[model samples]
Target: MNQQHPSMEVMCHVHNCKFNENDYCFAPKLEVNPLQGSGASNSKEALCTTFQPR
Candidate 1:
């Protein structure tokens, strides 16, 4: 069986990010990882691994 996921808005503030268009993320896929290998304790400690420099 195939599953379909609902689309949602992804807001971005990094003007230099390649996938950022009009303050929104347009990447085909989004990847978020912990800033450190250990783990993220808060939102600030997490990082967008899918970020690409424009």
Candidate 2:
């Protein structure tokens, strides 16, 4: 039997990010967390930017 959802790809441009490598985002899933400073408050957010449902 096959799964209902298919795998997808996500890309990110956040440099210095732990998950960033060679301008490619290898994050298997989207997970957001609270970000402090940098002007935007409550910036914690998680999302699957590269999700493709089939």
Candidate 3:
């Protein structure tokens, strides 16, 4: 199957994440969600659901 990478770079600071490489996210695909409410009002409210422990 063909795989497509995102044109934009995804920065990550979670060192324990399997997809984190040099502070950058390398996951083939990523998922994010709000910690609460219908939408996130700020970055603090946004959660990285794609994180997986290395």
Residue pairs of candidate 3 with colliding backbone atoms = none
Residue 38 shift from truth in candidate 1, angstroms? 5.2
Off by over 4 Å in 2: 1-6, 32-54
**RMSD in Å for all candidates:** 1.5, 9.7, 3.3
Model 1: CA > 4 A from native: none
Pick by lDDT: which candidate is best?
1
Among these predictions, the greatest TM-score belongs to 1
Residue pairs in candidate 1 whose N, alpha carbon or C atoms collide under 3 angstroms: none
lDDT of 3 at 20: 96
* Model 3 residue 37 distance off true place after TM-score fit, in angstroms: 2.7
User: Order of candidates by TM-score, top first?
Assistant: 1, 3, 2
Q: For each of the candidates, give the backbone clash count.
A: 0, 2, 0
Model 2 per-residue lDDT tens digits across residues 1-54? 886865666566676666677766666666544344333444343333343332
Candidate 3 lDDT at 53 equals: 99
Error of 2 at 50 (Å): 13
| Deviation from truth (RMSD, Å), model 2 | 9.7
**Candidate 3 TM-score over all chains jointly:** 0.80
What does candidate 1 score on TM? 0.83
Taking all chains together, the TM-score of candidate 2 against the true structure is 0.38
